[model samples]
Target: MEKQIAIIGGGIVGATAAYYLSTLPGGQQVKVTLFDDGLGQATTAAAGIISPWLSKRRNQQWYQLAKAGADLYPQLIHDAQLGTDVYQQTGTIVTREIPTDLELLFDLAQERRQTAVTMGSVTTLTAAEVQAKIPLLANAQPGVFISGGARVDGAALVAGLLAQATAKNLTIRRERVHLTAQGQVVTSLGARQFDRVIVAAGAWAKELLAPLGITADVRPQKGQLIELAVKDYPIQENMPVLMPEGERDFVPFGHGKLIVGATHEDDGKFNLQVDPTVTADLFASAQRLMPSLTTANITGTRVGTRAYTSDFAPFFGPVPDHEAILVASGLGSSGLTTGPQVGRLLAGSALYGGTPDWSEYEKPLATYLKPSAE
Candidate 1:
């Protein structure tokens, strides 16, 4: 009999795990089922920036995880057969409003090259030169460019993965899951037994794991973004993503769509309403980065409640006591970069047990994520 694997989420983590597990050695004898509530999830609202070098986070583990996330995009796109609609390598521009900031970014560029990170051509660009390639950029601020930066349409990618997984014998159930008993998960299709159940439900994970007494404490760090119709400005197509050091960032969505985001609102609610103040501030910020954005119209707004972890690292491994209930949550804002990597790790843990034991990390992660036990 084949091993039955039930994944309770259709977000990036669950979707990627379903796809990867089905392709592993001896995977032909496995049956995988993915459950989703059908509401579009957080990955859909991601800023989709794949530039790790631009981050100011100096923690060794954080840097390595983020870099790994960026480094895996190209191969992930190819392996998943995701087209350019879902993944595009338009590169990124990290700008600096001051000389010190510019020097720091330039120095990081050198560090990336020394560490064998192929950031295409890490070169400093004058405001005028940068504006020529991206006329919207503020011509007063200098920036360094990474020729290898890219963006992913998080929604498109997840949809594509789910579709592909469905085509490859993976079952998709649109319903909330219930853990009625040990070694079992109940969905809309009724109760069923599974060899292993993975809860990669993002922000909703801890509640789902309550039956097993695991505190996931996945905080929904809300990221609100404004998508503008920028084709009205006749800007260069495929202009690299731009972010002034320590300011709000913007990514150019293909077909004249540019995205500016994201406010880290940890208010702990499903507030999808685009706050007028936040939205206004994002627009003003974008306008400062790209002068032409002043003429752009607000085509739409997106709100993705990122699963912010205490340490900013996702929880990926089996629950300590209940080994069958694995988790891959709290991915925060880098789901696009870390999706494939998370999938691989969880798949290994679920299948052959070769993945790193995250026992020590799980308690710390849960303490940060879970509510008080009063």
Candidate 2:
């Protein structure tokens, strides 16, 4: 019989998993089913901004995954028939008023052998230098670090992945999943047996796993962002600029708008309402970082909840007692950059014994699974 795999969650992680599993060596004989309650509203809220360099400091594992995902975009776009304009390779700029601790950042990049360089002494940049790089960043502080990175339209990326999965004949079930013993899963739409099950439900993973005696300490970290529509703004390119204050990140989408985000709030609730205070704080930071955006009109604003683990690294690999189940959650803020690689890793683990230990890409499987009380 063909091996059956049930993937819970249709976000980037689940969709990418389905896509990769469908293309594996023996994947033609393998059957993949994806389950999700919501389409792209929950954790895949089209708010992801993909900048490889800025996300490098998170960890070596994440950096590798992000870099690998960056490499996968070209083929993914081609396979999905997604428009090339969906991905903007405008690069990213990391700016700081004074040089912050580049030691850890540099060490990480060096360990990964990443393409990073310290431009001269960490002195302030001239207005002309800033304009030459970011064109949008005017009246900025002295020091800045520029690196090669790309910005992906996350909404379009997810849509394209979904379309590709459908074209590949992967079954998608639009329903909630209820886990049974021994890693069996039942969905509202129907029930199917699988050789393995993967829980990529993001923030909701813990809820589904709780009934199965597995506990996931994943929490929802709320990130609120504002979109501004400024047609004539000089920052026409799609690059991310880090603010000097609190290390805020501002990404300009190529389509006459900029996304200023992100507040990490651990309220333990999934609140999607964009807070005015958060928006004001983000705008203030953006104006300080990119002065030209001060005149940009606010087009829209939104709040997204991301999944985070206790250790803040992702939870991957198989459940301890129930070997039939695997998890790929707790991506936090690097969902877009790391989602594809994570999916591939999980799929490989399912097919093979487990994910290969590629330097920092240690699968933290122990955190999600526990032995049943005797």
Candidate 3:
């Protein structure tokens, strides 16, 4: 009697869970079926910037998990032979004059007892420092601090994970899933009974769990990005730039291109339309940060939905009252930064019995074992 687990969604979190579950101790006996309707389109559409230090938060659980995931990226890239260039470990720079709430960030760092380097009086960078780091920013303002960070090709990572899962004999079904009252899951293709079912459906987790009497306080937040082609721009080596006090991030990617994003809108629209207003704002911001980008060719634009939790933390662990039903959603903007660790934790919990204790990572529906009155 081998254990069987069904995971819904093939985004970062779901796919990572599938990969880890298949590699768990004595995992050979466990069969994992991964279901995804969109298949790595939603949450995986992120810029894939891995910055744990920049994710400064009041909650230690999130900080810990984010750091853990960041640590895992290097190894994951190596294991997949995805090339070191696929991940930029050039670190991140947060400008000082960006009206950021440094008091909060410093307080969080202090609470976590993490070491932070404070450069004197410089709230922003001078044109020289900016040029030194990112030659493209020869005309940028002053006040900047560098933090340890990394950026990865998020889409490539997803593709590599799926390929690896296939090599390991895991089943991936591209279809929607409907769940039964007895914790069974049926897909458009077929029905299967699992010892455990993990719902990692991202934005749609709430809708999928509704019929099962489980509530996932998750929503879709639309974000957009623009790709720029700059063959000669002197972009920083693997460096990510945060702007407007961390409201958005600018990341460089493969083949002399950069990704400028994103707008956090709660309009619940999934259309890939790049809002002109948003794009203008993004372009202005990017040009201001890196002047060399002014000559860069606007390659293309894309829009994707991020799964957000009411409390802005991921939903992991088992669904209350249904021991066999588990959840792994609501990763929000940090899916790429936290997916690997969350997946490892969820896989361990599913195969074993106890959910990993991450008290500070709040899930909105964790307290609601039953649906609210309709």
Candidate 4:
């Protein structure tokens, strides 16, 4: 009999898993189904920043995971062979508002260089240089520029993966899936038994796994972004993604438009509505970063609930006692960067009952996550 596999959530992880499952060896015999709720999806609302090294996380496991995630972008973009309407290695700039922050990033660049990690060339730019490149910064603080950083459109990437997966014989279903205590999977369309089920439900993963006695240690973090058009004040064509310290970051979305994201608030609210306060703060930050933004048109706003893990690493692998019930969630603010890697590993583990070669960080990560602690 053929293996039955069900993937809950059609976000990046779920979509990538389906695409890889359709291509991995021994994956041909497995019948795969993907479920998507089509509501409040984090993937769609994400600013899709792929610059993980800019984060302050110092955990080795996390560093490796994030590095691998960033490394996969070029290949993915090429594999999809789609136009560069969404994914591109535009690189990132980590601006420093103070001298202390600049010193810290310089040290980090040295360490990253010694390890020969592919973080692109790390260049220290003077305050004026930053403003020259962006022309938006009123006070161009000195910062470290990472050449390997890339930008992605979360929604577009997911759509591409799903489209290719469909061509490879994967089934796509728009349904809210339910799992019974008896281990059966059901949906409004019908009920069925799957030999394996992978949940990549993003913010909603906790709700589905709680009843199964599995603690994913995941929480919903609401982030809001305001879109603006740069028609009045033109930016450099090869402009890099900018994180000019503090609470704001600017991402260019091509053709005189940019996305400034993400207020990280862990309130348990799921409304996904634009907050007046959030809008005001981000807009103010944008204008400060580049006074030119004052002339840009406000292209509405977006809100998403990203899944954040207690240990800052995504939840992956089997759900404790339930071998058939696997999970990949809590990718945090950098989900777009790590989503593809999570999919590849989850797919491999499901097919072969062994630790993946790139999963050396898994053991220590599992210990910290404490999915099922004593």
Candidate 5:
């Protein structure tokens, strides 16, 4: 009998898991089904920035997972055959307003580089030098550049991975679904049993787990951003991603296209509405660092919901009492950075029976997922 596996989400984690599980050796022994409603998924709305070595966060576990995820991109790109338009190693430039602060970040990058060889050459650049590298940057602040930093198109990545998996006979249902404690997936059509279920539903994991009497630590955070098109700036195509001191980071793509803004609204819960005032403010804030954006035409806007935990840490593993179900959430803005690796680990667990302990990469599953008091 074929092992039945159902993945309740089609975002980065779920899609990547589908790709791995369906394409792995002896995959014919297992059947994979992915459910995706195409709603406010965070991956499609994200500006995929892959630099994690310079993070100031003190979470050592998160740093480990993020570094590992960054390291997996080469394998992912190679296996998935992603085009240059889908993934690029143009590198990253991190700017700081205070010269001393920039110096501190540079020192930190150097200290971290000993362990993170993938960070490539870490160097400090004068404001003029930074401007030369990224012509749109107008800020006078000094910056640090990391050669290994890369950017990806999140939506493109998921599509490519899913396409690969689908070619391998992975079943995809375009419907919202829920799970039962008995290891069944309930779609609008009906309920079906599965040997295993993986929940990578982003913020909606809370609702999906509710029916199973589990309390998920996930909460919804609304993120909004805008894409801009600049005229006569072909060089903007391969310009390195510019992350200034604040929320407005710039991710450049080919054909003079750039992504900016991405306000992290912690209280905005699941709302996907694009507030013109908020977008206007984002453009204003972006103009502070790259005044050239003021003349660039706004091509489009994207609003998506991100999952976050109170402690702002990500967790993934089997449900406490319901080991048949696996869950991953609380990725927040770093989902693009850590998602693929998490998916790979989850797929490995499903393909080979018995969970591979990942306690070092995250807290215990019980910490974020627990039995409901009711």
Candidate 6:
């Protein structure tokens, strides 16, 4: 008899896992099903910037996982058959207000490149060079360029992965689901038994694990991003992702479009409402960085909930006492960079029947998913 596998959540992680389960070496030995609630999922609403080397966050394990996640993009792109419109290595620009800070970052990138050869090239851009790269900038500020940086469309990526998985007979249901203490998945239709269940439910994992007396350390964080239509600016298509030292990072897509945003609201909870004041503030920041944006039209806004832990670290593996139940969450703002690798690992563990050795990537699974007090 074939093994049965169920994955909850159709965000980047679950989608990628399903895709891998359909393509991995022993994947054909199991039957796979995915359940997606289609709520305020962060992947679809994300800015989708894949540049993690320039982050100042002081977590070595997190950094290692992030770097590895970045390195795996080429294989993932090829395996999933993603097109340039879905994922592109257009490179990234790191701009700092202080010239000395920019120089320091350039040096750091060079040092990191010794181990991360896939980072391509690192260069400090002169004022003229900065302008030549992105003419929309109000000031030709000094910047550091990383040739390996890339961007992805989260929704498109999930769609692409699911498309491939479905071709391999992966079942998908667009409904909310919960789990019984015995590791049974209960959807609106009915309960179903699976040899293994992977919970990749993003911010909603906390509530999904509650029925089993497991209190997930995951919490919902609200994020919002805006899209601007820059008329007649064909060059915007080739523009690199902009990483300013604040919340106003910018990502450009083809067809005269640019995305700016992502407010990390700790207090937003599970709220998905769009706040006009926040949107206005984001546009103002974008205009300050690129004055030319003042003439652009506000095309749309995207709001989604992201998952975060108290320590702001991500974890994935089997639940402590429930070996049959695996979970992945707390990705925070870096989900786009790390979700794919986490998904691949989870798929491998389910197929091989053991806990994934993520010692170098995060704390133990018990630290994030544990039983509630009696």
- What TM-score does candidate 3 reach? 0.85
Q: Candidates' lDDT values, in order?
A: 0.74, 0.67, 0.68, 0.77, 0.87, 0.87
Q: State the displacement of the C-alpha of residue 219, model 5, in Å, after optimal TM-score superposition.
A: 0.4
Clashing pairs in 6: none
- Which stretches of model 4 miss by more than 4 angstroms? 232-237, 355-359, 363-374
Q: Between candidates 1 and 6, which one is better according to lDDT?
A: 6
lDDT tens digits, residue span 219-271, model 3:
78888777777654545454444443433567765457777776778894555
lDDT of 2 by residue, 142-177 (tens): 434444355666666766776766676578877888
Q: Please give the lDDT score at residue 237 for candidate 5.
A: 65
> Between candidates 2 and 6, which one is better according to lDDT?
6
Runs in model 1 deviating more than 4 A are 138-140, 181-183, 232-237, 291-296, 354-374
For residues 90-182, write the lDDT of model 1, one tens digit per residue: 778887778787888799788876763646778888888777777655544688988888877778888888787777758988888878637
lDDT of 6 by residue, 1-374 (tens): 78999999999899989998999998888899999978898997876788888788899899999999999998899877889888898889888768788878988898888988768999988767877887666665778999999988888998899999998859999999899988899988788999999999988999888888899999998999888886445676677887877648888788877888889998897899999988998898788777766634788999999999999999998887788999999999999999999999999988888645789999887788878873
Q: For model 3, what is the C-alpha lDDT against the true structure?
A: 0.68
* lDDT tens per residue, model 4, 90-157: 77888887888798997887677665366778888898888777765577788888887777778788
**Model 6 / residue 227 / CA error / Å:** 0.4
**What TM-score does structure 6 among the candidates reach?**
0.97
The 10-residue segment with the lowest total lDDT in model 5: 288-297
